[model samples]
Target: MVTNEQSVAGPAAEQQGFLHQVKSFGRPFWAANVMELIERWAYYGVRAVLSLYIVDAVANGGLEFTHVQKGSIYAAWAMVQSLLPLFTGGYADRYGYKGTVAFSILIKIVGYLLMATQHSYGGFFLGCMLLATGTAVFKPGVQGIIANANLGNKASVAWGIFYAMVNVGGFIGPWAAGYLRMMSWAHVFYANAALVALNFIILLMFKEPERPAFEGKRPSPVTEFVGILFSSVKNVFEPRLAAFLVLFSGYWLMFNQLFDLLPNFIDDWVDTSGTLAWLGKTLGNPTMLQNGLAGGQIQPEWMINIDAGAIVFLMVPIAALFSRMKPIHSIILGILVSTIGIVLSGSTMVGAYCMLGIFIFAIGEMMASPKKLEYLAAIAPKDKMGLYMGYANVPNAIGWGIGSSLGGHMYQTYADKTTLAKAYMADKLHMTPEAIAAIPKNQVMETLAAQLGQTPRQVTEMLFAMHHPEHIWLVFGAIGIASMVGLIAYNAVVTRLPKPATV
Candidate 1:
């Protein structure tokens, strides 16, 4: 018999239970999430515009770097960012997380300030290194705090919340950056600096949570760093594990093309007037819309933000559906799906198709990214699972560094709209190459438009027809497909190998 007391107690107990689980996370988990969000915001804001800022002409307040230089800088930055955590994680463990986090913030502030002032390649690269170092110091500390706090049954939910917050910041960072960059590139840097400064203030209130005690006196940071570096080197050559990581690097190579090439691609190739027209018709002539569309096109950063946005909504459902699949199978499927998405996005100049491609790419990313870690954990000896998982960033570092360098050289050769325009002028228009080079890069489009008695958009279309810039897509598509195929071969070879002697 359901008495009044039992009925009232039933729902009340569940409510209390839920609150207890949340409270069990305590102060540190929430604080770490806040820090993660803000840091990602600053990082992505800088990244969203960095490639474009490097390559744009000096007359437009940009650095006017070559494609190779831009690609090298990006690749080097990614390598530093990924590798640092491996070296510095032990320092955070030995020293307190809170102090390490504060120091990292201070370093980042200096880095951003330096970036705002430096325009030369050497100075700018130094600034990027500083920023990467700061970020590397910060990531492990905050992640360590969150991981320690989410022990036991609450781990799954806590990680979910943490990832959601990350995506929130990621989406906003690029969305805001695309607008700020329009005012001036310096403004974007300054804004990111200010956000990092704000996080420093938040860091003041963070209380360090409990972590496992070290068994002995903590080694000096330099010693610890060297030891980790040696271990990383050793891991790369470790039998079947080495082969697995090498294959995994292929996916990241293709995935990174989104950031390394797509912004410049959109700026040069896509006609976003259709998107602008739709917005104008729906919202009417608002100042914000008009200012943002001054070039009669949407900013590339805004287009890229779609990937983050899609991940936020789609990841959970996609992960749930793929939960039953084998790890290797999911990874292979993911690469194929992502490759198709990349081809679709790049093969067209249409705004809608570009967005649709990113959406599909995000779905593929959801399918594979988590499983990469899962696969690593599965093959490890039970006692060494944590150590094996730590090496997961290896593929990202390798892939980004190699892929960006290669992609940049390829872009310079095949797809750079400016270079192709010059070729068209010398070949088809009967103009001297010297005269073409004399024109400012930014003015090339307008000058061509005037020469042909057409709009810049029409000239862009004409160039597409004559030069076949779409061929660049073929190159990128081949890279993605090749990576997918490489993974399949890796799986077959590794499965047949004798299981390694356990560490």
Candidate 2:
């Protein structure tokens, strides 16, 4: 037994035994992942159509809100979704994860039903708030299960699997929503409500996993919740951290345009005949062809889903490759790559090219997104890791909120074909803004095309050329590029500073 061969065998067996122990995470962790997938599907299904639903003509079963109003709504939604998790994490701890998840799903179901039926601005906003609150609560509980489960060295791989599930939901949701929305936009919301309701069955079966023990007397749950919320806000406002968050907001501003602006942009300008034809040939479904396609065109959400599809297929490989790179470098490179991709997406009205651009953007997104948390983790004190990580969401909130506002303004001023047509009419036909506003959007398009002696698409092309709405893409691209440059400067300055000596 004391021989060298026997001693080596003992260590090898111990290593295998240790791995088995780590891999023995229970059913609850897997159950959480399933819930996450369904929840994402429901959330994104409505999201894919929200911007379009807001701005379309009232006759088309839409709200027809002004760009400013749309911007405000979008900003508020982003703010709530991004910031509430800091407090909700404490709430989830105080309340059990299983009950929290069930309550969130119930709220989501009600929210979706409200969104489906309500057409007023106030009602929609209320619906959005409910959905965001439910989402904020759901996020921590689902991730908490995975984090608390003793996955050991396999945690990284487990998280990767979780992300893949998210992308799968992301891809499927929009695609299905796009089809259902063609029948009625409200159908998309109702479908999401039904899906959330279905999760109740899973909630009934899910068992809570054991949580790590907290030491010492803690504040009352309400007080503890308030404390966590304040601490997160305070940490974000710390001088150097504040600067970083502000600078990083530029990238988020540009990044979020994919959801906030791109749908409208594509609907206005892009020709989807090529994509439709390909789908027709591939699927050979006449119903899809007849009902779904307009002038041989596909829905904007279908095109947008390409980004999710790319992530689903390519993220793991891209993540593995970038794992060796520095986090800052990965972020900068990702921004630059995404800038190029977004610019390309907006450069033309071609559907195939737009798909290609989104594909490229997905590559950069996968490369940079994970590195953000990694970068924060490396800089955090061991004891304060959770707090520092909570602070990380600040830039995202800033970016999405501010970016949506700016994107709405830009869309109104530059990229809205109807708005530009009105401007052109005022300049050419001596019409006032009020006179232009009196004309129906469809009538205006028809009149313009008749006067210009071109088809409607050709008129759009002429207006696009004369006014250069695509310049908005350059504006966003410049923002991303500026962020990259700022990050570089920030890194250089930080590196030159002296390190504190460790005891």
By TM-score, the best candidate is: 1
Cα lDDT, all candidates:
0.78, 0.77
For model 1, residues 1-503, the per-residue Cα lDDT tens digits are 00000000011223335557667777778888898889888888888778788899989999988889988887898799877777777787778788888889888888888888899999988888889899989977887887777446666666666777777788789988888988999998898988977776776666777778889877777787788788767765777677777877888887888877888888889888777766776787675457546747788888877888877677668877987788788888998888888878888899879878878887788777777777876677687666677777787888889988888888887788887777777887888878898999899888877877999888888888877766776777787787788888877776776754111
Residue 367 CA displacement from its true place in model 1, Å: 0.7
Structural RMSD, model 2: 7.0
* C-alpha RMSD of each candidate structure in angstroms: 6.9, 7.0
Q: Which stretches of candidate 2 lie over 4 Å from their true place?
A: 1-25, 214-218, 238-240, 278-294, 431-438, 451-453, 499-503
Q: Model 1 scores what on Cα lDDT?
A: 0.78
- How does candidate 1 fare on TM-score? 0.91
- TM-score of every candidate: 0.91, 0.90
Clashes per model (N, Cα, C within 3 A): 0, 0
Model 2, total clashes: 0
